[model samples]
Target: MPQLDHGANALVGVMAAFGRFELQQELSGLTAVQAWNLLSPFLPLSQTDPMAFTELLCHGVTPAGGFAAYGASRALAELVGLSFDTPAAQAVLDGGIAFLREAGVPPMRVRPYEWDRWLDTGGNVESWLPVRPPPPPERPGITPLRPAETRLVAKLGAEQDSNRVFISRDGTDFVAIVDARYSDEDPTRARWVWHRASTLYLLYLQVGRSLQTPPHWVAAELEAYVPLPAPRF
Candidate 1:
């Protein structure tokens, strides 16, 4: 495996390092190798041609690429073990993070294999990118989500016996779920908030957590959930 230039092997190695269950069965009985050993062939490439290295793991133009980038980058970062003691490892980790930001956020879409609908789109962005996406510029009149707005903000899951929805668009945008009973008349179902570890919630983080000019309609709707301001006396 000396000429492992394509990086799928490195990605797979990272996946195994992270204990991906599927890889477990396939990799068993093999002499255990360190994640670094798997990534060794790519280290020089990462230092000299980081973007090319990124392209090896990232399928930039594909639908699933958005969903995969952060997880892949984070896995690489963790496998490398980010610490000052390991500057070489840190540089490699930094390169991966740089590649993610350079690639930018993909246009909003549902995760591959998901139903083609907006609610499902929330799961597309996957995870918080390794670096902080620059914050959206502050607008003079911009305000945060309010109770009224939270009520209108779309819930994460569809209507079912017990489904979770995002009831608020405040703070970092990963609002905690509130438990309440669901009713036919009330669209809010038991305030059942399911935390999707990956998805457009990452999109929120990508845009620096601003609702103004959201990246997608669901986000726009969440932002628009606010009521018109009362006339100031």
Candidate 2:
């Protein structure tokens, strides 16, 4: 059994929290804090107790819940040099996403209007209306690819191309859902969509390791990276 480091332990707690919050949000469409009374029992002795943490996860987190949890876990691991690209890490992430999809949590999307309001109001925005401004057109040599985007493209074995990038009108952020072949004619090439929630998960892990509070802009940037489904409500 591998020992849990400070960073890993903190990451487990973050994942657990994210799992709980995502479940609550999905079931009620509301974001609420986990009640202290409800969460105290499963608290780990330290940040690196993967066993205790995994046990708690087994008891409370489902597959859909795992999506948020595992995503956060992987991000934390990556930041702390914990080998996120390992087979174990991949299993955790794949299992979590599968679980969420099976549980009927809709595919995630980016909603910029809500994000803007969240930033303006210090995360007190209440509306879910689709209201974000269109992302600035992808400039020829100006836009920078986020770390996550770069990592994901590399994972997909695709070369980076500026023309391949597109921005969501709702969230006004860059997206890397481009052809794996980097060709205009082959529409069937692989494309991966990166979301704000996923990026937020990464940021949360970063913050947890530093034990530092992130400014609202960090959250706002993450929110811009969130991917959303078509409007249904």
Candidates' RMSD to native: 15.4, 18.7
* lDDT, candidate 1, 81-136, per-residue tens: 33313333333333333333344432221122211221232423334223223434
TM-score of each: 0.30, 0.26
* Poorest lDDT segment (10 consecutive residues) of candidate 2: 208-217
lDDT (tens digit, per residue) of candidate 2 on 174-217: 33343355456754556555333233334323222221221112
> lDDT of all predictions, in order shown?
0.37, 0.37
What candidate 2 gets wrong by more than 4 Å, as runs, is 1-20, 23-31, 35-38, 46-48, 55-89, 103-233
Error of 1 at 56 (Å): 12
